[model samples]
Target chain A: MVKKTSQRISVASLDDLVNVAGASQEQEQQYRYHICICVAAGCISQNSDAVRDALIAEVEARGLEDEVQVKGVGCMGLCAAGPLVRVDPDGIVYQSVTVDDVPAILDSLENGPVEKLILPQDIPFFERQQKIVLENCGIIDPEAITEYIAAGGYLALHKALTEMTPSEVIDVVTRSGLRGRGGGGYPAGLKWVTVAKAESETKYVICNADEGDPGAFMDRSVLESDPHRVIEGMAIAGYAVGANKGYIYVRAEYPLAVERLELAIKQARWAGILGNGVFSTTFDFAIEVRLGAGAFVCGEETALIASIEGRRGVPRPRPPYPADYGLWGQPTLINNVETFANVAPIIRNGSDWFAEIGTEKSKGTKVFALAGQIVNTGLIEVPMGITLREIVFDIGGGLPDGRNYKAVQTGGPSGGCVPEQFLDMPVDYESLREVGSFMGSGGMIVMDDSSSMVEVARYFMEFSMTESCGKCIPCRTGTRQMYDLLSKVVAGEASQSELNLLVELGDLLQNTCLCGLGKAAPNPVVSTMQYFEDEYLERLVDDNGSADEPAGES
Target chain B: MPAQATAETSAADKRWKLVEATMRRNGYRPDALIETLHTVQGVFGYIDREALKFVAERLPVSPSQIFGVVTFYHYFQMKPQGRHTCSVCTGTACHIKGSKALLDDIEAHYDLKDGQTTPDDKVSLLTVRCIGACGLAPAAVFDGEVEGSVTPDLLHERLDNWLAEEDEGNGEEN
Candidate 1:
């Protein structure tokens, strides 16, 4: 098949952008069918790229290259059964496709659906999800600017810049009830307003894509699938907050995400969407990608800013948050990738449309990376207030092989494990905090009865201890001490006094740590102790036990 | 501190030119320290003391500060990697999926712990927090290829095959 270049359009005004969108749509209508193969990291690792190559070659051999648009797209959500291929019009999704299966996929495009290969699209994994952030994820070719334009990608930025004033954009975001998706549930609009109101003439908008949560990949998915969406969101944010420069501090581990962002930025710049005078408005916005060199603490705004400044990612006191003084001491607006992603949609759909979805406090949907023992382990964007049961059992397809659900871990090292009793609990920011966990970058690792709660606590403690930046006494020394005590408990050698000491350390860390990392470090241990006190008691060494026989003795 | 050290990182090396290009793009400022080091490591596979001292001089950063930043980030490695590298995912999902057993099995089988290379300079093993592919639990990257649903036996089998190719290549060289 002929290698295609991303269609670029130079738009000087809103009408020009609309015409570009129309022309892109008209071009897309030429193809009788569209074949989008999952090319996100998850599916790519499953050799979907090679399958795409094979399908494209086959398309060439069949002389149907013009009729069929065989392109690589982003994550299809069901990652476990990738490489997933979706044929348009019929919306038939084929999972676990191989190079050898390429011929059959093409044959089915002409013929009917391959009955055995079809992954039923009506399942809760697809049907239950309400896609706001991920609306154009698997649908649009992330590399193609025309595809994004056709999908109504940058119209929100166009609308925000041309129609509304800076404060009006901020007002819409404020009324939408959207909060930061970067673990901290700070209001996104409030942050925009503060930066907009700040006295500094030189303001910066930083997209915090340094998603360090171990099990989280929401940012990665959004970046990999629809990178221009993030670029558009940042542009809108820059317009609202009176910032002309933007930087995305994404993690280096996600090489694919970095590459996609770089490519998308180039495409945006080439199309006159990123560089100076975007959409012919006097507003000048430029975005550059800065790679995070594998530090989890950099997810913190202060630490992230420090990292971007080419220093060690160490968190300092936050009285002067990033909103006030950030990125070389400028009034900066930093929003999580998912938070920024919500901006364009909120603008297009209107605040009331966004506010009407989900719970009272947490409006809009959340994208979760469901992993661990869950059957449908991939990515899901569900409305807020959706219960953990619906997420784990219905959307996730529950624990595999009929295992009993023990706990579902949210928020990586900083969050807690929710027991079976709270499976029905609505997964919003406030509700998760009530269960001693917070809506951290949306990574839910569902565990079955086979998992030990104490061991899980020890695991998170070890993560915290190892990842500690050693800048603060409370976090550096405290995480180490807590990790040691938890290790002893896991080894069945900890006494009741040691467990009590661990609780005390948790309180001390929460109260005195320098940053959120240290403050929330003890959450997993503390939450486990709260709900599974018996497990700790059972593991505690008996006072009257013989010297040779420890608590682990039968 | 030495002019001779600057002489060693001469502009003729071409590798230093790439490093110079990165610094030049950042206007040779102190803030280019991390990006400079990233380019160094990306080109050389690992950053060394030589690269560090040279970068410290080229950019407006101090040696102590460059060293501090380099060591702070886990992605920067001081030593050269072996011919092949295996990175096991120790993310929450992988840990729950018996990645610990896989790790232990690897240690026992290779007689090397995390961040260690085989004495023959054939393989290096390390652990990463996450590669953000938790859907494939107990995943590991063999060289640049990521394989999922890895068990102790499965990894060992893969290693045997991967190393067997190395052995065949060596035999041909002899």
Candidate 2:
């Protein structure tokens, strides 16, 4: 296979490859209107595939197949009302589309946009988004490599292999100020530099796709929508880190994402984009997929490494981090799926372009899976430092059913809930931590006034209790104790002393857990206690000093 | 190994051969334990004692450690399953959207608990957390197919039909 194709394109072919491919594709398929249906997981659940088929059939029946082409693309981000269909060149998007309404949609293509059926594209939900990670999403056929090539995929890899030195590649990422998007906001450049400078004969790069955070689908969407982009990003990372082998550790629960990624890898290999002498260079890199069997703690780097090594997925203390010693006792570079997704743009458009998008400290955009009680429950990528108020009210379409907003939980179970008072706070790494939350893998769940804060705390505590790897005593027993205490408090059976004990235990878990899973387990409990202590007081037993009464009569 | 050439033992021989092939494909290293287990589960729905021992021997890991790895992960099933399986999402979003009610409804219908199989071996029910489809809260994975926004009435009807179809097929087989 290597000998059959010319790898001699090398550094010289880097500049013209993508431009030539994209130009030819645009010239060949110059349709008047392109009908793109949202075939992401959210819309697919609402039977978007049938709606897509109906649109194609309608176009074919009207003999407008050549004029109008219907294609299935990734998430359009307005998932609460789906299946969403967008007509390109006209910019008319229809929401909650059904097979019955396909004719009216096609008719609107001829006459005018349907008033009731058309979703307002001018709304902040679509307008306020700064999409760099999701640049080609919802616009390209993910299953086709030619479409990816036409969309300028692998251009960064070609340029990096041909133009930039390994250290120069690392410097560009460092200047971009790109932090890790997988919960922890560690600087990705520092990690890459350490791995690049590691004194080892063999090194490995890992793309952590085990998106275990509840309500987070950003990684899955990226992989499903533009798998080649992640591949290109990873290939570029492999080049910069001086590693020739890569592994993508994705959860097995996402069967669709796994299938698409497998296909993308195969296509890249067949096109000579993944194998040895990629872009006609001497560098040889191959990627393999490893499936995680439903372990939440595997999202932790050490635990993920253990899972990849075919052992019980458990975390060890850090010092000899994966960069220094990892994956069968060799130097390994690990980054979140979203972190790698941001690599190509930084390399192609230059670091200054990316550094200008977000806040002064947190550069570039962040993709979040906005869901729960929000009217526009879907995936969205917005610039860093965007306010929670803007994300929830403007982008998320606020609460549904005219309900009053209560609080929004960010970073899944590892994060805290921010009350309406902090709605205007900018959503950056420092701001989130200041509010007692960490940007954990981009799951922002909105809670309405109908929700009970105590129950929410108990829910996250239960999650932590169940998902604790039980490798150490503190996490194993501490999460269980905290969950029990929260349950008792929720049931109105806890004394004031027990509530105090719950607070103390939360502090204990905060300071003394083995891994991030246990360390951040008590975030929900503490944050709810901080903001909604009145709710807890209301749920407490009577203060009459009776048998059921709490002793502390504060 | 070639001594067992009888037709009666060919099925077992073929299963062993596949297990061997999967182990070899993974380079027969201990690092391929999880992948090997996944392949074994793909071939056989549940990892039985024989399967675990076979994986341990082929991957060169101790049987006890193999058992530890299998028990550590939530996805691995140790016992044989019923004719059908259904997993209900109990994540926070699903819980807020009344997944508990759906579970209660299923419990009443099948006279089973959250992680139990009916005495007739017709169905097994399990509760999981957030399958990443929060847009469709109160979701369920029935035989590995995600069905979202599931209501009690809808779930009951679907499960009833699924059971009836299985029974009809069983009746025909008989």
Candidate 3:
């Protein structure tokens, strides 16, 4: 009787936790200077903790402990210049802060600013970036529920629940021109409407945090920096899509991200944003975290659903999409982290406000985990219609050490490489697709002059081939064969016939592959062939097989 | 304590008997000891060489198979590790960008090697896969910290502090 009573109490508490919403507006306004140190997975590995310690020591040493509160925050997106530390309420952003600079920063804290460490707002990198998704990053302590509330975190969910209907929310999202940031560019609102109208007794909302794109850390950053926002977004999604329960399918490799998210879920439940009747409304919602076992293919929706169900991570043919039948044969709505992150802002600020920022086709800002040879590499959230040149040159601060830009590989292995000629192209979903690249989960790897195009193509193909789930013949066989041809080309062993065969195979795989993974696997090879065919031709061996032997080969 | 001892004894006795039985069944050979050990480890998560040798004494396969298989996968370990293991990426990209300096700082400060554990068995330092953020090169993984673009000065200060806190925790436990 005692155990049963306790269980009932626990269930009631859980229900109360989920239903609670609306961050209490009452917060202390006593000014305390915040020093946010980037402790995202990327910056932490770089010893950002030391930077934090140094800042704290400096503050204590100067006896400014009362005046300032030093804290560890999530990624500030300028990953190339980590460990990033930002001083507020001045909003003086500092990049690549080392232990040696701590004393100087503290000394300047009293009088003015550390001019040397200050990230000038006028700089192209900061000027060009129109941060929306990353607005809270470097501004608030990620773990603090109150800080998130103070920043209007749960207001969108509150508004959606109290003011709008499910169809109304979908209509706003659809009218705002938001598409899936998961590289598919599918209409997000339309997808949600389909799941809502599917007449299923049970439905699921899954946040695709299993970001497997190589060189991409955008989703991970969001999870680490502001987990509450994602929870709020997922809650909003749950309310809109009629999903009683939600699952965040994150990779096991992201332990920090997972830890923070788990904490956020607990906090959200406590705040009454996640569990039973959210925001005092009749709508019910809950979320569970399903960890992926480090399978790259699990990023695909069907495979992700399979992995969630405790099955081997693999993709299946579409027709019955996850919206129609998913997660234990129930209708499901799956959206990437970035896509979900956009929900609250759109709801709070209105659709027209969100739509005014980018191109007609693509609305709002897109976050890119800017990586590779580019300078100022990190997480960057920029307006959608911003040109590739602005992202690569202005926001990215161009290639490191004045190296000439070769090509920018966007959308990971599945996305194509845009050559220097297309640098001026506006980086929206449509514009990127026009040049054979899709804005896949926002992984932009900028290559310099030293980066061999042929080698880059082979590298991406190798990644796709290894990650292919072998669900369909075209992808399973086609990717491996293309990888072999690219490898031969890299080794200067390929004849003209092999090159033609590679192109032929690329086209075939694009058309015939069962899912998105296989369909887009040949993107790297296709784009490279389109732009750098000469590089492939140059690698071709002559009639004599002796030329096929790579340099230094026995 | 007595129950634990009995369980251990029974486990050891059972494993020994199984090894002997399997060896007798398979026609074991002396040279095939390591191979048999690897096969046993593959089925299980770890290797008990006595069981391995017992299997080897019966099987036709060479012991080299066991050694080869043990060394093949990154997951398999020859010995148990400390509670917390830190792996620093020293790939070509990471190496070029001062990862060597950071590694050296960690080694000198902690008195560790590529796969060596601390004297107290609190922390172990190892080298591993690229950690995949080549853009933020010079990366390290503390348990699973996934820090990127690390430098020697920062590594020394942070690692020393972490180690000191760990030592304090150890003292409390004792």
Order the numbered candidates by lDDT, best leading. 1, 2, 3
TM-score of the A-chain for all models:
0.97, 0.95, 0.92
lDDT by residue (tens digit), candidate 1, A1-554 = 21346355576777777887888788777899888899999998889999998988999999997899888898889999999999987899998999999888888876899888899988999999999999998988888877788788788998998899999999999999999888888998888899999988899999999889888888999999999999999999999999999999999898899998998898888778888898777999999889899898999889999999999999879879888888899999999999999999999989999999999999999999999999999999999999999999999999899898999999999999999899888989999999898799999999988889999999998888888899999999999999999988888787766878999999999999999899999999999988888888787886543342334432
Best by DockQ: 1
By DockQ: ranked, best first:
1, 2, 3
lDDT of 2 by residue, A1-554 (tens): 01113322222255456654656477436778888898877778788888988888889899997788787888777778888888888778888898999888888877988888888889999999989999888877777666677777778888899899999999999999999999788999999999999988899999999999887888988998899899998999999998899999998888889998998898788777888788778988999999999999999999999999989999999989999999888899999999999999899899999999999989999999887788888889999999999999998888988999998888888999999999999999999999888899998888888889999999898898989999888899999998998898888877777789998988888899989999899999899989988788766775342465434456
In candidate 2 the C-alpha lDDT for residue A478 amounts to: 94
Give the C-alpha miss distance for residue A506 in model 3, angstroms.
1.8
Q: State in Å the error of residue A402, model 3.
A: 2.4
Angstrom error at residue A392, model 2: 0.6
Question: Measured against the native two-chain assembly using Cα atoms, what DockQ does each of the candidate structures obtain, in the order listed?
Answer: 0.80, 0.67, 0.13
What TM-score does chain B get in every candidate? Answer: 0.88, 0.85, 0.58
Q: Could you tell me which 10 consecutive residues in candidate 1 chain A have the lowest summed lDDT?
A: A545-554
Residue-level error in angstroms, candidate 3, position A544: 6.0
Please report the candidate that would top TM-score against the real structure: 1
TM-score, prediction 2? 0.94
Model 2 chain B TM at: 0.85
State the lDDT of candidate 1 residue by residue for B35-124, as single tens digits.
Answer: 889999988899888898788777767889888998999999999987788999999999999889988898888787899988777788
| DockQ of candidate 3, scored on C-alphas against the true complex (2 decimals) | 0.13
Candidate 2 C-alpha error for residue B158, in Å: 1.3
